[model samples]
Target: MRVLRYLVLAGLVATAGTAVAAPVTYKLDPGHTMVLFSWNHFGFSNPTANLGQVDGTLVYDEKDPSKATVEATLPLSGLDTFVPKLDEHLKSSDFFDAAKYPNVTFKSTKVTPAGKGKLKVTGDLTVHGVTKPVTLDVTLNKVGPHPMMKAQTIGFDATATIKRSDFGVGAYVPNVSDEIKIRITTEAHDASAEKK
Candidate 1:
Protein backbone atom coordinates (compact mmCIF):
# COMPACT_ATOMS: atom_id res chain seq x y z
CA MET A 1 0.00 0.00 0.00
CA ARG A 2 2.96 2.32 0.69
CA VAL A 3 4.28 1.79 -2.87
CA LEU A 4 0.80 2.50 -4.30
CA ARG A 5 0.60 5.76 -2.30
CA TYR A 6 4.03 6.87 -3.54
CA LEU A 7 3.10 6.14 -7.17
CA VAL A 8 -0.10 8.21 -6.86
CA LEU A 9 1.81 11.12 -5.32
CA ALA A 10 4.36 11.12 -8.16
CA GLY A 11 1.61 11.10 -10.79
CA LEU A 12 -0.15 14.04 -9.14
CA VAL A 13 3.05 16.04 -9.12
CA ALA A 14 3.61 15.45 -12.82
CA THR A 15 0.04 16.47 -13.60
CA ALA A 16 0.41 19.68 -11.63
CA GLY A 17 3.62 20.57 -13.42
CA THR A 18 1.93 20.18 -16.77
CA ALA A 19 -1.00 22.34 -15.68
CA VAL A 20 1.00 25.58 -15.54
CA ALA A 21 -0.54 28.16 -17.84
CA ALA A 22 1.41 29.67 -20.71
CA PRO A 23 1.44 33.33 -21.67
CA VAL A 24 -1.15 34.63 -24.10
CA THR A 25 -0.29 37.00 -26.95
CA TYR A 26 -2.73 39.68 -27.95
CA LYS A 27 -2.58 41.99 -31.00
CA LEU A 28 -3.32 45.66 -30.46
CA ASP A 29 -6.33 46.94 -32.34
CA PRO A 30 -5.10 49.82 -34.45
CA GLY A 31 -8.50 51.45 -34.76
CA HIS A 32 -9.00 51.50 -30.99
CA THR A 33 -5.48 52.29 -29.86
CA MET A 34 -4.70 55.98 -29.46
CA VAL A 35 -1.86 58.06 -28.09
CA LEU A 36 -2.39 61.68 -27.05
CA PHE A 37 0.20 64.20 -25.91
CA SER A 38 -0.21 67.71 -24.57
CA TRP A 39 2.20 70.52 -23.73
CA ASN A 40 1.92 74.05 -22.39
CA HIS A 41 2.16 76.86 -24.92
CA PHE A 42 3.93 79.83 -23.28
CA GLY A 43 1.72 79.42 -20.21
CA PHE A 44 -1.23 80.52 -22.30
CA SER A 45 -2.86 77.11 -22.93
CA ASN A 46 -2.10 73.46 -23.39
CA PRO A 47 -2.23 72.15 -26.91
CA THR A 48 -2.82 68.45 -27.50
CA ALA A 49 -1.97 66.28 -30.47
CA ASN A 50 -3.19 62.84 -31.39
CA LEU A 51 -1.15 59.98 -32.81
CA GLY A 52 -2.94 57.13 -34.47
CA GLN A 53 -2.10 54.03 -36.53
CA VAL A 54 -0.54 52.39 -33.51
CA ASP A 55 0.45 48.74 -33.75
CA GLY A 56 1.89 46.36 -31.22
CA THR A 57 1.71 43.10 -29.37
CA LEU A 58 1.20 42.39 -25.69
CA VAL A 59 2.09 39.16 -23.94
CA TYR A 60 0.37 38.53 -20.65
CA ASP A 61 0.51 35.75 -18.11
CA GLU A 62 -2.34 35.78 -15.66
CA LYS A 63 -0.54 33.43 -13.32
CA ASP A 64 2.56 35.60 -13.24
CA PRO A 65 2.10 39.24 -14.10
CA SER A 66 5.83 39.82 -13.96
CA LYS A 67 6.20 37.76 -17.11
CA ALA A 68 4.19 40.28 -19.11
CA THR A 69 5.77 42.27 -21.94
CA VAL A 70 4.77 45.08 -24.29
CA GLU A 71 6.08 46.40 -27.60
CA ALA A 72 4.45 49.21 -29.54
CA THR A 73 5.14 51.47 -32.51
CA LEU A 74 3.66 54.91 -33.15
CA PRO A 75 3.87 56.46 -36.58
CA LEU A 76 4.46 60.17 -36.83
CA SER A 77 2.76 60.21 -40.19
CA GLY A 78 -0.54 60.05 -38.40
CA LEU A 79 0.12 62.99 -36.13
CA ASP A 80 -2.62 65.62 -36.05
CA THR A 81 -2.59 68.84 -34.02
CA PHE A 82 -5.80 70.45 -35.43
CA VAL A 83 -3.87 73.42 -36.80
CA PRO A 84 -2.53 72.79 -40.28
CA LYS A 85 0.29 75.30 -40.10
CA LEU A 86 1.37 74.08 -36.69
CA ASP A 87 1.18 70.49 -37.91
CA GLU A 88 3.44 71.31 -40.83
CA HIS A 89 5.93 72.99 -38.52
CA LEU A 90 5.91 70.10 -36.05
CA LYS A 91 6.55 67.57 -38.79
CA SER A 92 9.24 69.79 -40.28
CA SER A 93 12.87 70.03 -39.21
CA ASP A 94 11.97 72.20 -36.23
CA PHE A 95 10.33 69.72 -33.88
CA PHE A 96 9.78 66.00 -34.40
CA ASP A 97 11.47 66.02 -37.82
CA ALA A 98 9.07 63.35 -38.82
CA ALA A 99 10.50 63.04 -42.28
CA LYS A 100 13.79 61.86 -40.85
CA TYR A 101 12.60 59.93 -37.82
CA PRO A 102 9.26 58.62 -38.94
CA ASN A 103 8.33 56.44 -36.02
CA VAL A 104 8.38 56.40 -32.23
CA THR A 105 8.67 53.14 -30.37
CA PHE A 106 8.54 51.66 -26.88
CA LYS A 107 9.63 48.30 -25.61
CA SER A 108 9.07 47.34 -21.99
CA THR A 109 12.03 46.01 -20.09
CA LYS A 110 10.35 45.37 -16.76
CA VAL A 111 6.82 45.08 -15.46
CA THR A 112 6.01 45.35 -11.77
CA PRO A 113 2.59 44.99 -10.27
CA ALA A 114 1.72 48.18 -8.44
CA GLY A 115 -1.67 47.17 -7.05
CA LYS A 116 -4.86 45.45 -7.99
CA GLY A 117 -5.23 45.85 -11.77
CA LYS A 118 -2.33 48.28 -11.97
CA LEU A 119 1.27 48.01 -13.18
CA LYS A 120 4.44 50.06 -13.38
CA VAL A 121 6.06 49.50 -16.76
CA THR A 122 9.62 50.56 -17.36
CA GLY A 123 10.72 50.80 -20.95
CA ASP A 124 12.91 52.49 -23.51
CA LEU A 125 11.20 55.19 -25.53
CA THR A 126 12.72 56.25 -28.83
CA VAL A 127 11.71 59.52 -30.40
CA HIS A 128 13.37 61.94 -32.80
CA GLY A 129 16.38 59.66 -33.10
CA VAL A 130 17.05 59.62 -29.36
CA THR A 131 16.27 56.93 -26.82
CA LYS A 132 15.40 57.42 -23.18
CA PRO A 133 14.07 55.28 -20.40
CA VAL A 134 10.56 56.10 -19.23
CA THR A 135 8.20 54.60 -16.73
CA LEU A 136 4.50 54.41 -17.37
CA ASP A 137 1.72 54.03 -14.84
CA VAL A 138 -0.64 51.54 -16.37
CA THR A 139 -4.10 50.40 -15.41
CA LEU A 140 -5.53 47.18 -16.67
CA ASN A 141 -9.01 48.35 -17.43
CA LYS A 142 -10.57 45.03 -18.44
CA VAL A 143 -9.80 41.53 -19.65
CA GLY A 144 -12.64 39.54 -21.06
CA PRO A 145 -14.58 38.66 -24.18
CA HIS A 146 -15.67 41.42 -26.52
CA PRO A 147 -19.37 41.07 -27.17
CA MET A 148 -19.20 42.55 -30.64
CA MET A 149 -15.99 41.03 -31.95
CA LYS A 150 -16.63 37.70 -30.28
CA ALA A 151 -13.08 37.44 -29.11
CA GLN A 152 -11.06 37.59 -25.94
CA THR A 153 -9.89 41.16 -25.36
CA ILE A 154 -7.92 43.26 -22.95
CA GLY A 155 -7.79 47.03 -22.41
CA PHE A 156 -5.26 49.30 -20.77
CA ASP A 157 -4.86 52.98 -19.94
CA ALA A 158 -1.39 54.35 -19.31
CA THR A 159 0.17 57.74 -18.63
CA ALA A 160 3.67 59.15 -18.56
CA THR A 161 5.61 62.39 -18.73
CA ILE A 162 8.82 63.11 -20.58
CA LYS A 163 11.00 66.07 -21.41
CA ARG A 164 11.15 66.82 -25.11
CA SER A 165 14.77 67.84 -24.66
CA ASP A 166 15.62 64.32 -23.60
CA PHE A 167 14.54 63.02 -27.00
CA GLY A 168 16.18 65.79 -29.07
CA VAL A 169 12.80 67.31 -29.92
CA GLY A 170 13.19 70.46 -27.90
CA ALA A 171 12.67 73.34 -30.29
CA TYR A 172 11.45 75.79 -27.66
CA VAL A 173 12.28 74.58 -24.19
CA PRO A 174 10.83 77.04 -21.69
CA ASN A 175 8.27 78.57 -23.99
CA VAL A 176 6.78 75.30 -25.24
CA SER A 177 6.89 73.62 -21.83
CA ASP A 178 9.84 71.26 -21.89
CA GLU A 179 7.81 68.56 -20.27
CA ILE A 180 5.18 66.73 -22.31
CA LYS A 181 2.30 64.78 -20.83
CA ILE A 182 1.31 61.60 -22.59
CA ARG A 183 -1.80 59.45 -22.40
CA ILE A 184 -2.38 56.13 -24.11
CA THR A 185 -5.41 53.91 -24.39
CA THR A 186 -5.33 50.55 -26.13
CA GLU A 187 -7.52 47.54 -26.71
CA ALA A 188 -6.00 44.23 -27.73
CA HIS A 189 -7.54 40.99 -28.76
CA ASP A 190 -6.20 37.49 -28.93
CA ALA A 191 -5.39 36.87 -32.57
CA SER A 192 -5.79 33.15 -32.10
CA ALA A 193 -9.44 33.69 -31.27
CA GLU A 194 -10.11 34.35 -34.92
CA LYS A 195 -9.34 30.72 -35.73
CA LYS A 196 -12.19 29.59 -33.53
Candidate 2:
Protein backbone atom coordinates (compact mmCIF):
# COMPACT_ATOMS: atom_id res chain seq x y z
CA MET A 1 0.00 0.00 0.00
CA ARG A 2 2.82 2.40 0.82
CA VAL A 3 4.61 1.58 -2.38
CA LEU A 4 1.49 2.27 -4.38
CA ARG A 5 1.01 5.57 -2.65
CA TYR A 6 4.59 6.60 -3.25
CA LEU A 7 4.22 5.73 -6.91
CA VAL A 8 1.20 7.95 -7.20
CA LEU A 9 3.00 10.80 -5.45
CA ALA A 10 5.91 10.48 -7.87
CA GLY A 11 3.54 10.67 -10.80
CA LEU A 12 2.03 13.77 -9.31
CA VAL A 13 5.42 15.48 -9.01
CA ALA A 14 6.16 14.51 -12.60
CA THR A 15 2.96 16.00 -13.93
CA ALA A 16 1.53 19.07 -12.30
CA GLY A 17 -0.81 20.69 -14.81
CA THR A 18 -0.05 20.08 -18.46
CA ALA A 19 -1.33 18.07 -21.42
CA VAL A 20 2.17 16.85 -22.25
CA ALA A 21 3.93 17.20 -18.94
CA ALA A 22 7.68 17.72 -18.70
CA PRO A 23 9.11 14.40 -17.68
CA VAL A 24 10.60 14.23 -14.22
CA THR A 25 11.89 10.86 -15.22
CA TYR A 26 12.41 8.97 -18.44
CA LYS A 27 12.84 5.25 -18.29
CA LEU A 28 15.40 3.86 -20.67
CA ASP A 29 13.95 1.39 -23.12
CA PRO A 30 16.82 -0.99 -23.80
CA GLY A 31 15.12 -2.15 -26.99
CA HIS A 32 15.24 1.42 -28.27
CA THR A 33 18.62 2.43 -26.84
CA MET A 34 22.07 1.52 -28.13
CA VAL A 35 25.57 1.52 -26.69
CA LEU A 36 28.48 1.42 -29.09
CA PHE A 37 32.22 1.56 -28.71
CA SER A 38 35.26 1.45 -30.95
CA TRP A 39 38.97 0.96 -30.49
CA ASN A 40 41.95 0.89 -32.84
CA HIS A 41 43.10 -2.64 -33.61
CA PHE A 42 46.86 -3.04 -33.17
CA GLY A 43 47.44 0.40 -34.65
CA PHE A 44 45.31 -0.65 -37.59
CA SER A 45 41.58 -0.28 -38.26
CA ASN A 46 39.09 0.51 -35.58
CA PRO A 47 37.04 -2.39 -34.24
CA THR A 48 33.47 -1.60 -33.31
CA ALA A 49 31.21 -3.41 -30.89
CA ASN A 50 27.77 -3.22 -29.36
CA LEU A 51 27.57 -3.66 -25.61
CA GLY A 52 24.32 -5.24 -24.47
CA GLN A 53 21.62 -4.40 -21.97
CA VAL A 54 22.23 -0.79 -21.05
CA ASP A 55 19.48 0.25 -18.66
CA GLY A 56 18.86 3.43 -16.71
CA THR A 57 16.83 6.51 -16.00
CA LEU A 58 16.86 10.13 -17.09
CA VAL A 59 15.41 13.09 -15.26
CA TYR A 60 14.73 16.09 -17.46
CA ASP A 61 13.54 19.63 -16.97
CA GLU A 62 13.15 21.32 -20.33
CA LYS A 63 12.72 24.74 -18.84
CA ASP A 64 15.79 24.17 -16.72
CA PRO A 65 17.93 21.61 -18.47
CA SER A 66 20.62 22.18 -15.89
CA LYS A 67 18.49 20.07 -13.62
CA ALA A 68 18.64 17.18 -16.06
CA THR A 69 20.56 14.03 -15.17
CA VAL A 70 21.20 10.66 -16.77
CA GLU A 71 22.28 7.40 -15.27
CA ALA A 72 23.28 4.28 -17.19
CA THR A 73 24.49 0.82 -16.26
CA LEU A 74 25.79 -1.82 -18.66
CA PRO A 75 26.72 -5.40 -17.99
CA LEU A 76 30.43 -5.70 -18.69
CA SER A 77 30.23 -9.37 -19.56
CA GLY A 78 27.75 -8.61 -22.30
CA LEU A 79 30.41 -7.05 -24.54
CA ASP A 80 30.20 -8.29 -28.11
CA THR A 81 31.97 -7.88 -31.41
CA PHE A 82 29.89 -10.34 -33.44
CA VAL A 83 32.38 -13.14 -32.78
CA PRO A 84 31.61 -15.57 -30.00
CA LYS A 85 35.18 -16.74 -29.47
CA LEU A 86 36.56 -13.23 -29.39
CA ASP A 87 33.82 -12.10 -27.09
CA GLU A 88 34.63 -14.86 -24.68
CA HIS A 89 38.32 -14.04 -24.81
CA LEU A 90 37.63 -10.38 -24.17
CA LYS A 91 35.58 -11.26 -21.12
CA SER A 92 38.31 -13.40 -19.64
CA SER A 93 41.01 -12.27 -17.22
CA ASP A 94 43.21 -11.24 -20.12
CA PHE A 95 40.96 -8.33 -20.95
CA PHE A 96 37.91 -6.91 -19.22
CA ASP A 97 37.68 -9.77 -16.76
CA ALA A 98 33.94 -9.71 -16.44
CA ALA A 99 34.24 -12.31 -13.71
CA LYS A 100 35.93 -9.85 -11.41
CA TYR A 101 34.10 -6.75 -12.53
CA PRO A 102 30.69 -7.45 -13.97
CA ASN A 103 29.39 -4.01 -14.67
CA VAL A 104 30.29 -0.53 -15.79
CA THR A 105 28.24 2.52 -14.92
CA PHE A 106 27.85 6.24 -15.40
CA LYS A 107 25.94 8.73 -13.29
CA SER A 108 25.67 12.33 -14.34
CA THR A 109 26.57 14.88 -11.67
CA LYS A 110 25.82 17.97 -13.68
CA VAL A 111 24.24 18.93 -16.99
CA THR A 112 25.35 22.29 -18.26
CA PRO A 113 23.79 23.92 -21.26
CA ALA A 114 26.27 24.32 -24.08
CA GLY A 115 24.03 25.62 -26.79
CA LYS A 116 20.55 25.20 -28.21
CA GLY A 117 19.45 21.93 -26.64
CA LYS A 118 23.04 20.78 -26.34
CA LEU A 119 24.67 19.99 -23.03
CA LYS A 120 27.94 18.92 -21.53
CA VAL A 121 27.15 16.27 -18.97
CA THR A 122 29.83 15.75 -16.40
CA GLY A 123 29.78 12.44 -14.64
CA ASP A 124 31.71 9.64 -13.03
CA LEU A 125 32.27 6.71 -15.33
CA THR A 126 33.23 3.49 -13.62
CA VAL A 127 34.96 0.82 -15.68
CA HIS A 128 36.62 -2.39 -14.54
CA GLY A 129 36.41 -1.27 -10.92
CA VAL A 130 38.02 2.05 -11.67
CA THR A 131 36.12 5.31 -11.41
CA LYS A 132 37.02 8.48 -13.23
CA PRO A 133 35.47 11.77 -14.11
CA VAL A 134 34.31 12.00 -17.70
CA THR A 135 32.49 14.46 -19.83
CA LEU A 136 29.92 13.50 -22.42
CA ASP A 137 28.90 15.80 -25.20
CA VAL A 138 25.17 15.40 -25.36
CA THR A 139 22.71 16.60 -27.95
CA LEU A 140 19.04 16.60 -27.11
CA ASN A 141 17.51 15.47 -30.37
CA LYS A 142 13.85 16.09 -29.58
CA VAL A 143 11.11 15.74 -27.04
CA GLY A 144 7.43 15.73 -27.88
CA PRO A 145 4.61 13.79 -29.49
CA HIS A 146 5.11 10.27 -30.73
CA PRO A 147 2.40 9.08 -33.06
CA MET A 148 3.52 5.46 -33.09
CA MET A 149 4.21 4.77 -29.40
CA LYS A 150 1.25 6.76 -28.10
CA ALA A 151 3.55 8.30 -25.50
CA GLN A 152 5.82 11.30 -25.19
CA THR A 153 9.43 10.47 -26.02
CA ILE A 154 12.86 11.96 -25.63
CA GLY A 155 15.85 11.37 -27.87
CA PHE A 156 19.49 12.12 -27.24
CA ASP A 157 22.92 11.36 -28.68
CA ALA A 158 26.00 11.37 -26.52
CA THR A 159 29.70 10.60 -26.87
CA ALA A 160 32.66 10.19 -24.55
CA THR A 161 36.23 8.97 -24.98
CA ILE A 162 38.57 7.52 -22.41
CA LYS A 163 41.85 5.70 -22.13
CA ARG A 164 41.51 2.02 -21.32
CA SER A 165 44.75 2.04 -19.35
CA ASP A 166 43.45 4.62 -16.93
CA PHE A 167 40.69 2.26 -15.92
CA GLY A 168 43.19 -0.65 -15.51
CA VAL A 169 41.85 -2.41 -18.63
CA GLY A 170 45.23 -1.99 -20.28
CA ALA A 171 46.25 -5.20 -21.92
CA TYR A 172 47.19 -4.36 -25.48
CA VAL A 173 48.13 -0.75 -24.78
CA PRO A 174 50.19 0.74 -27.63
CA ASN A 175 49.83 -2.41 -29.73
CA VAL A 176 46.10 -1.87 -29.82
CA SER A 177 44.51 1.50 -29.14
CA ASP A 178 44.32 2.55 -25.52
CA GLU A 179 41.69 5.09 -26.39
CA ILE A 180 38.11 3.83 -26.25
CA LYS A 181 35.29 5.81 -27.76
CA ILE A 182 31.78 5.41 -26.39
CA ARG A 183 28.65 6.48 -28.22
CA ILE A 184 25.10 6.29 -27.04
CA THR A 185 21.78 6.89 -28.78
CA THR A 186 19.07 7.06 -26.16
CA GLU A 187 15.36 6.70 -26.86
CA ALA A 188 13.59 7.22 -23.57
CA HIS A 189 9.87 6.66 -23.00
CA ASP A 190 8.27 9.39 -20.96
CA ALA A 191 5.56 7.92 -18.75
CA SER A 192 4.97 11.22 -16.94
CA ALA A 193 1.68 11.77 -18.83
CA GLU A 194 -1.11 14.29 -18.19
CA LYS A 195 -1.80 15.43 -14.65
CA LYS A 196 -4.83 17.21 -13.33
Candidate 3:
Protein backbone atom coordinates (compact mmCIF):
# COMPACT_ATOMS: atom_id res chain seq x y z
CA MET A 1 0.00 0.00 0.00
CA ARG A 2 2.82 2.48 0.78
CA VAL A 3 4.60 1.73 -2.52
CA LEU A 4 1.37 2.15 -4.48
CA ARG A 5 0.69 5.52 -2.84
CA TYR A 6 4.18 6.80 -3.75
CA LEU A 7 3.73 5.70 -7.40
CA VAL A 8 0.38 7.49 -7.64
CA LEU A 9 1.82 10.67 -6.21
CA ALA A 10 4.73 10.55 -8.66
CA GLY A 11 2.35 10.09 -11.56
CA LEU A 12 0.30 13.11 -10.47
CA VAL A 13 3.40 15.25 -10.15
CA ALA A 14 4.52 14.37 -13.69
CA THR A 15 1.10 15.26 -15.09
CA ALA A 16 1.13 18.61 -13.32
CA GLY A 17 4.50 19.44 -14.79
CA THR A 18 3.20 18.78 -18.30
CA ALA A 19 0.18 20.97 -17.71
CA VAL A 20 2.35 23.84 -16.57
CA ALA A 21 4.34 23.69 -19.80
CA ALA A 22 1.34 23.46 -22.13
CA PRO A 23 1.08 26.11 -24.82
CA VAL A 24 -1.61 28.80 -24.63
CA THR A 25 -3.41 30.14 -27.65
CA TYR A 26 -3.87 33.87 -28.04
CA LYS A 27 -6.19 35.64 -30.47
CA LEU A 28 -4.72 38.59 -32.32
CA ASP A 29 -6.18 41.97 -31.42
CA PRO A 30 -6.68 43.70 -34.72
CA GLY A 31 -7.00 47.05 -33.03
CA HIS A 32 -3.55 46.76 -31.53
CA THR A 33 -1.78 45.14 -34.46
CA MET A 34 -0.39 46.76 -37.59
CA VAL A 35 1.50 45.46 -40.62
CA LEU A 36 3.65 48.04 -42.33
CA PHE A 37 5.77 47.81 -45.47
CA SER A 38 8.27 50.03 -47.21
CA TRP A 39 9.85 50.01 -50.64
CA ASN A 40 12.26 52.27 -52.54
CA HIS A 41 10.37 54.36 -55.04
CA PHE A 42 12.34 55.04 -58.25
CA GLY A 43 15.57 55.25 -56.25
CA PHE A 44 14.23 58.49 -54.85
CA SER A 45 12.47 57.82 -51.55
CA ASN A 46 11.30 54.84 -49.55
CA PRO A 47 7.53 54.98 -49.37
CA THR A 48 5.51 53.09 -46.80
CA ALA A 49 2.15 51.34 -46.78
CA ASN A 50 0.14 49.67 -44.04
CA LEU A 51 -2.36 46.85 -44.00
CA GLY A 52 -5.29 47.82 -41.81
CA GLN A 53 -7.20 44.57 -41.46
CA VAL A 54 -5.13 41.88 -39.78
CA ASP A 55 -6.15 38.76 -37.91
CA GLY A 56 -4.31 35.81 -36.50
CA THR A 57 -3.81 33.19 -33.82
CA LEU A 58 -0.67 32.55 -31.88
CA VAL A 59 0.16 29.53 -29.75
CA TYR A 60 3.06 30.20 -27.46
CA ASP A 61 4.66 28.45 -24.54
CA GLU A 62 7.32 30.37 -22.77
CA LYS A 63 8.50 27.25 -21.04
CA ASP A 64 9.10 25.57 -24.39
CA PRO A 65 9.54 28.36 -26.90
CA SER A 66 10.19 25.92 -29.72
CA LYS A 67 6.52 24.91 -29.60
CA ALA A 68 5.35 28.39 -30.58
CA THR A 69 3.44 28.86 -33.82
CA VAL A 70 1.68 31.75 -35.51
CA GLU A 71 -0.69 32.15 -38.42
CA ALA A 72 -1.84 35.53 -39.71
CA THR A 73 -3.89 36.94 -42.56
CA LEU A 74 -3.93 40.45 -44.00
CA PRO A 75 -6.42 41.70 -46.53
CA LEU A 76 -4.73 43.21 -49.58
CA SER A 77 -7.67 45.57 -50.09
CA GLY A 78 -6.84 47.25 -46.78
CA LEU A 79 -3.44 48.37 -48.00
CA ASP A 80 -3.05 52.07 -47.39
CA THR A 81 -0.25 54.18 -48.82
CA PHE A 82 -1.59 57.47 -47.39
CA VAL A 83 -2.36 58.52 -50.96
CA PRO A 84 -5.68 57.53 -52.40
CA LYS A 85 -4.47 57.27 -55.96
CA LEU A 86 -1.38 55.29 -55.01
CA ASP A 87 -3.43 52.95 -52.83
CA GLU A 88 -5.83 52.41 -55.70
CA HIS A 89 -3.00 51.74 -58.09
CA LEU A 90 -1.49 49.21 -55.71
CA LYS A 91 -4.73 47.29 -55.60
CA SER A 92 -5.11 47.19 -59.38
CA SER A 93 -3.77 44.45 -61.65
CA ASP A 94 -0.49 46.29 -61.94
CA PHE A 95 0.34 45.51 -58.34
CA PHE A 96 -1.31 43.26 -55.76
CA ASP A 97 -4.28 42.53 -58.03
CA ALA A 98 -6.44 42.67 -54.93
CA ALA A 99 -9.58 41.85 -56.88
CA LYS A 100 -8.35 38.33 -57.44
CA TYR A 101 -5.71 37.69 -54.79
CA PRO A 102 -7.39 39.46 -51.93
CA ASN A 103 -5.31 38.33 -48.99
CA VAL A 104 -1.76 37.72 -47.82
CA THR A 105 -0.99 35.04 -45.25
CA PHE A 106 1.86 33.65 -43.18
CA LYS A 107 2.25 30.43 -41.27
CA SER A 108 5.23 29.85 -39.06
CA THR A 109 7.32 26.79 -39.73
CA LYS A 110 9.89 27.13 -36.96
CA VAL A 111 10.58 29.32 -33.95
CA THR A 112 14.01 29.49 -32.37
CA PRO A 113 15.44 31.63 -29.64
CA ALA A 114 17.81 34.16 -31.09
CA GLY A 115 18.83 35.87 -27.85
CA LYS A 116 17.28 37.54 -24.82
CA GLY A 117 13.64 38.34 -25.58
CA LYS A 118 14.21 37.66 -29.27
CA LEU A 119 13.26 34.90 -31.67
CA LYS A 120 14.10 33.91 -35.23
CA VAL A 121 10.87 32.91 -36.93
CA THR A 122 10.88 31.12 -40.24
CA GLY A 123 7.60 30.99 -42.06
CA ASP A 124 5.87 30.62 -45.39
CA LEU A 125 4.45 33.86 -46.73
CA THR A 126 1.93 33.97 -49.54
CA VAL A 127 1.57 37.22 -51.48
CA HIS A 128 0.12 37.88 -54.91
CA GLY A 129 -0.72 34.17 -55.18
CA VAL A 130 2.92 33.19 -54.75
CA THR A 131 4.24 31.40 -51.70
CA LYS A 132 7.78 31.70 -50.44
CA PRO A 133 9.67 31.07 -47.25
CA VAL A 134 10.71 34.08 -45.20
CA THR A 135 12.40 34.65 -41.88
CA LEU A 136 11.49 37.39 -39.43
CA ASP A 137 13.61 38.81 -36.68
CA VAL A 138 11.20 39.10 -33.78
CA THR A 139 11.44 40.77 -30.43
CA LEU A 140 9.10 40.13 -27.55
CA ASN A 141 7.78 43.48 -26.41
CA LYS A 142 5.79 42.49 -23.37
CA VAL A 143 3.80 39.69 -21.80
CA GLY A 144 1.47 40.51 -19.02
CA PRO A 145 -1.81 42.23 -18.16
CA HIS A 146 -2.61 45.05 -20.52
CA PRO A 147 -3.00 48.37 -18.77
CA MET A 148 -6.03 49.44 -20.78
CA MET A 149 -7.95 46.22 -21.26
CA LYS A 150 -6.90 44.57 -18.00
CA ALA A 151 -6.41 41.33 -19.90
CA GLN A 152 -3.49 38.99 -20.37
CA THR A 153 -1.69 40.08 -23.51
CA ILE A 154 1.52 39.40 -25.39
CA GLY A 155 3.17 41.83 -27.77
CA PHE A 156 5.87 41.40 -30.39
CA ASP A 157 7.67 43.39 -33.06
CA ALA A 158 8.90 41.58 -36.14
CA THR A 159 10.67 42.58 -39.35
CA ALA A 160 11.44 40.84 -42.63
CA THR A 161 12.71 41.64 -46.11
CA ILE A 162 11.33 40.10 -49.28
CA LYS A 163 11.84 40.68 -52.96
CA ARG A 164 8.61 41.67 -54.70
CA SER A 165 9.75 40.01 -57.93
CA ASP A 166 9.82 36.63 -56.23
CA PHE A 167 6.16 37.03 -55.37
CA GLY A 168 5.15 38.00 -58.94
CA VAL A 169 4.40 41.63 -57.97
CA GLY A 170 7.35 42.92 -59.94
CA ALA A 171 6.23 45.72 -62.25
CA TYR A 172 9.22 48.04 -62.64
CA VAL A 173 11.63 45.97 -60.62
CA PRO A 174 14.93 47.76 -60.94
CA ASN A 175 13.26 51.17 -60.86
CA VAL A 176 10.42 50.80 -58.36
CA SER A 177 12.56 48.50 -56.21
CA ASP A 178 12.37 44.74 -55.97
CA GLU A 179 13.12 44.50 -52.27
CA ILE A 180 10.42 45.37 -49.74
CA LYS A 181 10.86 45.71 -46.02
CA ILE A 182 8.02 44.59 -43.76
CA ARG A 183 7.56 45.49 -40.13
CA ILE A 184 4.84 44.15 -37.92
CA THR A 185 3.79 45.06 -34.42
CA THR A 186 1.17 42.92 -32.79
CA GLU A 187 -0.54 42.47 -29.42
CA ALA A 188 -2.57 39.37 -28.77
CA HIS A 189 -4.93 38.63 -25.92
CA ASP A 190 -5.33 35.28 -24.29
CA ALA A 191 -8.50 33.85 -25.80
CA SER A 192 -9.30 31.80 -22.74
CA ALA A 193 -8.99 34.79 -20.43
CA GLU A 194 -11.01 37.00 -22.73
CA LYS A 195 -14.04 34.78 -22.28
CA LYS A 196 -14.12 35.63 -18.63
Instruction: Please list the C-alpha lDDT of all candidates, in the order they appear.
Output: 0.90, 0.84, 0.92
* Lowest-sum lDDT 10-residue window in model 2: 15-24
Q: Which candidate, 1 or 3, has the higher TM-score?
A: 3
lDDT of 3 by residue, 1-196 (tens): 9999999999999998896567879999988888999999888899999998888899999787878999999998778899999999999999899999999999999999999999999999999999999999999998877888887789999999999999999998899989999999999998887888
Q: Write the per-residue lDDT of candidate 1 for residues 1-196, one digit (tens) a residue.
A: 9999999999999876654345778899989988999999999999999888988899988778888999999998888898988888889999989989999999999999999999999999999999999999999998878999898788999999999998888888899899999999999998788567
lDDT tens digits, residue span 1-196, model 2? 9999999998886776553445467778788777898999877688788777888888888778998988989997668799888788888887888899888899999889999979999999888889999999999999876778776778999898989899898897888888999898878877455221
Clashing pairs in 3: none
What's model 2's TM-score? 0.85
Q: After superposition, which runs of candidate 3 have C-alpha atoms over 4 Å from their true positions?
A: 1-21
TM-score (all chains, Cα) for each model: 0.88, 0.85, 0.88
Best by TM-score: 3
> Per-residue error at 145 for model 3, in Å?
1.6
TM-score of 1: 0.88
For model 2, what is the C-alpha lDDT against the true structure? Answer: 0.84
- Using lDDT as the yardstick, the better of models 1 and 3 is 3
Worst-scoring 10-residue span by lDDT in model 3: 16-25
TM-score of 3: 0.88
